[model samples]
Target: MNLEVLSQHMNLISLVVLAVVVAIGFIKKINIGFFSIGAAFILGLAGQMSAKDISKGFSSSMFVTLVGVTFFFGMASQNGTLDLFSKKIVALVGKRTYLIPILMFALSAFISAIGPGHIAAGILMTTFAVYLAFELDINPMATALYAKLGANAGCASTLSMTGILAKNLSEPLGYTGFGTHLFLTTLLSGFVFTLILYIYYKGYKVKGDNPLKLSDIPAFNRDQKITVAAIVIMVVACIGFKLDTGLFAFVAAAVLILLGCADEKKAIKSIPWGTLMLICGVGVLVNVIDKLGGITLVSDFLSSHMNQSTAAPIMAATSGILSWVSSTTGVVMPTLYPICDNIVKTFGSNVSYVELISAVTATSFAAAISPLSTGGAIIMSSYSAAKETTTDEMNKMFKTLFLLSVMNVVINVIMAALGVFNLGHLFY
Candidate 1:
């Protein structure tokens, strides 16, 4: 780890800078993307890569995807469609306030499973769930946590975002036919986490007078109806036809605006520009890390310490830790899928590859609620947008999320060790 050794090992150097970037960004309140981009440049140059080659790390596709989906959902939020729609759903349970959290959890899972993916579902639903927490006298922390958990849970279907990514990655590594089991692992493990959140928040004992009544509430107006239709079309396209979610969303949003159904200014403003920069910027550094073999180094480091009994849990733990600061879909899966091959080779063929893959996907997503990740960011940003929050409050929430995320990862780790995720026989 000396300077000369680090200079020759650009991957180690990049990882050192990545660790530093996270530290400085957290302590100084600076966007990590700024530091990530700078690190990319330095690392790329030191590796003899040109500036243009380094700039290629910028993920333009992800940028457009976020912008388009957010713009569409932003319009939905601004037009009161989100509020009214969520209220209508809440009204279904009447005064049984206890069902509120459960309903939101189920709804979040279903929405994410349908195909918009966790990012789109988590952003839109976590925002609405927070708003509902305020509207209905429920705990915002529990509400947002359920939303994030549910989104992550159902997003592992082969038809969905993370699930599709898992398939593509695993297929090449000869871990085919893992989609169904991976989905089941995430869904069941996610429910376990949701149950814990429910108990901790006393969801069953929740009592509140819901002011909304289905009988009294008016139906959607002409404009709202149009917005609803637009949304339905986007959902149908994404699910039924397997269209590009962001592109379809943009098209749907544009049609709604053309029909005079949404406020152009407010819809534009509702897009989370800062969050976009954070994800895409860190994404640049992630690209650099991938190209420089930093992710591979970390994966190798973890694999070097495994044995027959310890392999599954250790792999799960490693994926969880890496996912705290990285994208589970974009980075973790691609790096770890191949490592499963190595694990099997070293430890004999008795190791369940499906179990290992499940451990990776399940535990990595368990850490998604950390403040450094998108789902947790939505919770904080949505909270601030809903009310006047102090910097101290934000910091406190950040710490709280990290703790909750650790608890979640621990739950999955125990499950991994218990062989709960071992569904290999069903498929293989």
Candidate 2:
């Protein structure tokens, strides 16, 4: 075979191997990261990638971010600070138990909008939201969904990773005002989804016979007090001052350890190392795929199939589907947005650059709720950590989250097809 044909075949085989890894993980209930790392080694060797090149695929930044954030929060949980804060929030809501989910949703969105990204926000919010739900006899599944959706809502802000990526990708194509338009689209869709979840979950019917009194809530202990202050500082430093969140979290966690607020061994064990491995291992494999031209192959397929009338929905669906097992920000957006620019060039006025990018942005983020994605993984971990949730219950929750992600993709696809929330014209 010629070099070109060999390259294409290599890319195709690598993709198939990736799908198999995902399937094996799902079926065997194993950590997919181990499978992914194995696949990367095999594929990298087959594709003639050097050892150094293969090592570059591991996303150290992402690994540190996941470890640091989870460790910091784990310390908080161990110190009883998360419980104390949950009680205060619950007490503040009083007898109106229906507002709990909504509050969690809004708080998640606000947290992401300011900084910390969707997965970080989901980790922080879902942990507390699930705990609160269990305590209040609320639907933990509904609360978890709302919290994740809220993170999606605000993850398109200018300061967010998704927003920065979208801007960088679209700006070279003469697309301005991408951040505002994408943020608004995400916000509107998130609000609608939250509303539906609230009504369907019968949140309106939730009422407590006796409201929690502020006076009855126990005062914070010395450890909890220090931990809370550290958390606040971490947020301010990361969000307000634009510090590296993971590094800041690590420093804060170290301080907590030194202060005797958290058990060092337990805190170390609390980090979600499986999730980090899954993400980083997949990152390495995806880098191999890119090097083997898999991304180009997918982009070429999309370019060939796209036309004026079908472009919006096709692009949105393509992004959502691929992002199910990949990083939307790191892989999907970077690969697909350039293809969008190509489409705009090829079709001219027939394809709206703004609408296309907006659809891609919205749909890509909507799929972050998938169980395979980081945000969804965090939610699953949070639910799993709860003493009240059983193994069977966690399995059911996974199915629920997967279905929710599918529904989210369908909704965004429909919205894009119907031009429901396309704010691209404003940018024009």
Per candidate, the number of residue pairs that clash is 0, 0
Question: Can you tell me which runs of candidate 1 are displaced by over 4 Å?
Answer: 1-7, 111-144, 151-184, 200-202, 322-361, 368-403, 419-428
Residue pairs clashing, model 2: none
lDDT against the true structure, each candidate: 0.78, 0.75
Which candidate wins on TM-score? 1
Q: What digit string (tens of lDDT, one per residue) describes model 1 on residues 334-391?
A: 5576667667766777788888989999999999999988778888998889879999
